[model samples]
Structure formats: structure tokens, C-alpha cells
Target: MKFFSKRELIILTLLFVLSFVPVVGGAIRILEIAGGPSVAPDNPRISNDPFPALLHLLGAIPFCILGAFQFMPSLRRYAPKWHRLNGRIVAFSGIVAAISGLWMTNYYALSIEIQGDLLYVVRMVLGTAMVLFIVRGVAAIRGRKISQHHASMTRAYAIGQGAATQTLMGLIWIALLREEPTGLMRDIMMTSAWVINLTLAEWIIRKTNNLSVSGSVS
Candidate 1:
């Protein structure tokens, strides 16, 4: 079980590391006074100034990377103060990411549905859930409910990592589907980004509790 936890952390680390490229790319675009291939030109998000894209990427970099380390047994055991400090950062960054995401969703024009059905409703629901989970997790910690905190944060982190998973799943969809998804199929494939990550996170939480079953999380 310990081995499994370690493996899971390693995987999360890889995903978090992989997230840097796009995050940095988006950041650079945000800096540009106006001269870069618009990742989503028509989508009011990138077109606007300080919006949905820039803020989300800014929040995502710290949130994804910092949250990834929280499960490291060594760090938790030897430097708990650091973990707590970093957790505070992660919590705030997570909220930022969620809010920015919702902002994008509210205004992101679904110009095309070929990639996947990333509908407005989907974004609203998921974004709201992410924020709530983070709040609940923080509350749990304040109340000394470490297990509950672990579960809630796990859910929040799982949702946040959707950014990374979507990239990977997008590749898989392109490779396997051979044909782009549209309509309901597109929606399911798009939403699968979060669903897949959350599924794994749930498994990790179960494995963690099984291994330690202690006040401190794995």
C-alpha cells in the first residue's frame, strides 16, 4: 500500500511537471501586448485582457505543482510546517484556478465543437464543485478532521489536474478516435478529462487510508 501511494505521487508529479509547458505558454501569451497564435482567438477568453486565460494559467502553475507535493511522505514527515504553508498556497491558488475557469466558461464562445463538447453548464458545475471541495477541505483541516480534509483536497486536486489530463486524453482521442468527436460524444470525451482524474484520485484516497489509517494523510 505504501508502495502504491508512492507510485501515485510519482504519477501526479509527472502530470504536474507536464502541465508547465502549456501553463508557461499561456503566461507568455498573456504578457504579449498582442502577437501570438491565439490558442482560442475567438473565445473572448484570450481576446480579453486579464481574463479567463491569463488568470487561470497563473493560478494553475502554483496550484498544480504545489498540490502535487503534498502527498510526499518524506516532506510531510520531516517538514510539516512547509507542508502547511504550501497547503495554504495551494488552497488559494486552487480557488483562483477554479474561478478563472468559470469566468472563461461563462464567456468562452463555443465556436467549434469538433474537439469536444465543453459546454457552459459543464464548466459551471465542475468549477463550483472545485471551489466547494477546496473550502470543505480547508474547513476540515481547521476542525482537525485530517481524513476529511484529505478526501476533500484529493477531490479538489483531482479536478484541478483535469488541465493535464485533458491534454493527454485529447491526444488519445485524436489517435484512437481517428475522427473528431462532436455533439454528445464530444461532450463525454471532453468531460472525461475530469472524470478520469477524479476516478484515479478516489482510488488513491482509498489506498492511502488503507495504508496508514492515521490522523495524518499519506
Candidate 2:
């Protein structure tokens, strides 16, 4: 632990917390599917379809949780081979998650009245963009463009994390506003979720590279 610089320690802590969100969500979904109570399937707009939700949960576990550890500098430093191995796992599973999200946006907009079309459109655009970013990351790694690979993958992962952020934001909206969001208010908040997450991801990506360039552990 003493060997880790402050920045590295902070990043490690962040990764651990970030990994918790989706993995726990995934576990809960799996339990829900196994006949544990879940409010998810009761959504009228989603057509009560459990298929996409199932796929999304399964994909999310590996993409969000396992993917987070790929950012650990210690792992990369001491286990380069393991890093490369799990990098492949992260990339592939992320694609599955991205595609399932897009499928839900395009064909599973069952919560149209509650979620609104704008949120659907937001998911469509962001979901497709996430897939492209994942593909770009893979290509960058294949070409041995390490920096671009990292940046692209960082963007992909952050975009995926929007699901977690949106849940938190939704809770805040309900608590502070003292009511559930609807219409334009809901649309604005949902759109902001992805936009904010991606923007922050870009900043962190650049910061990590800058630190790496300056001979600091990123």
C-alpha cells in the first residue's frame, strides 16, 4: 500500500466503489429473475418483457464490475498477462451490454408514457455510441495504440455507468423535488445522466494519461 502514490490510491478506491454499483444491481436482478420480488417487470411501458433485462443484467456484471478492476495500476503492473486476458473479457461483455441496451431502447420502450420517448432516444444514441467506443477500444489495442485504447474504453465504461448514476439522480429528483419526474423534467434529467458521465470520463482519461506522461502512477 505504501508503494501506491496518492493518485493511484484514490483511483483504486474509486474503482472499487464504481464496481459495486452494477455488480450488486446485477445480483439483485438475477435474484429477481429467480422469483424474488422485483418491481422491474411491473413496468407497463417495457411490455413486461424479461428477455432484454436478463441479457442486460448478465452483461452488466462482467462489463461494469470486472471491467473496473482493469483500471487497477497494481494489477497491470504485476499481472500484465492477467490484464490482457481480462481486457478481452471486459471488451466482449461490454459489447453485449451495449447491444442489449440499444435493443431495449429500440424495441423495448414499454415505459414510453412513464419514461418518455426522449429518454428512449437518448438511450438509442448513447447506447450505439457506447458500442462504437468499445469497438474502437478493441481496434486501438490491436494496433497497439495504448493511449487511445484506454481513452476509448474509459468512455465506454463511463457511458455504461450512466445507468447507475441515473438511478441515484432519479432518487434525488424524487426526494428533493418531492415528486417523481415526468414529461420534460424526466427527459432532461435522463439526458443529463449520460452527458455528465461521459464528460467526466473524458476528463479522467486525460488526467490519467497526463499523470502517466509525468512519471506518476496513473
Tell me, by lDDT, which candidate is best: 2
- C-alpha positional error of residue 145 in candidate 2 after TM-score superposition, expressed in Å: 0.3
lDDT for each candidate structure: 0.77, 0.80
Q: Model 2 over residues 1-218: C-alpha lDDT tens digits?
A: 46555776787677657556556767776777777877443554333787787788788788877787777777788778999999998888888898988887777655544557788788888889899999999999999998898899899998888877776788889899898887878888878988899899989898989998997854
Please give each candidate's TM-score: 0.81, 0.85
lDDT tens readout by residue for model 1, 31-118 = 6525655554344435654556767877888888888887676667777899899999999999998998888776665555633345
Locate the minimum summed-lDDT window of 10 residues in model 1.
Answer: 110-119
Q: How accurate is candidate 2 locally (lDDT)?
A: 0.80
Local error of candidate 2 at residue 11 (angstroms): 3.5
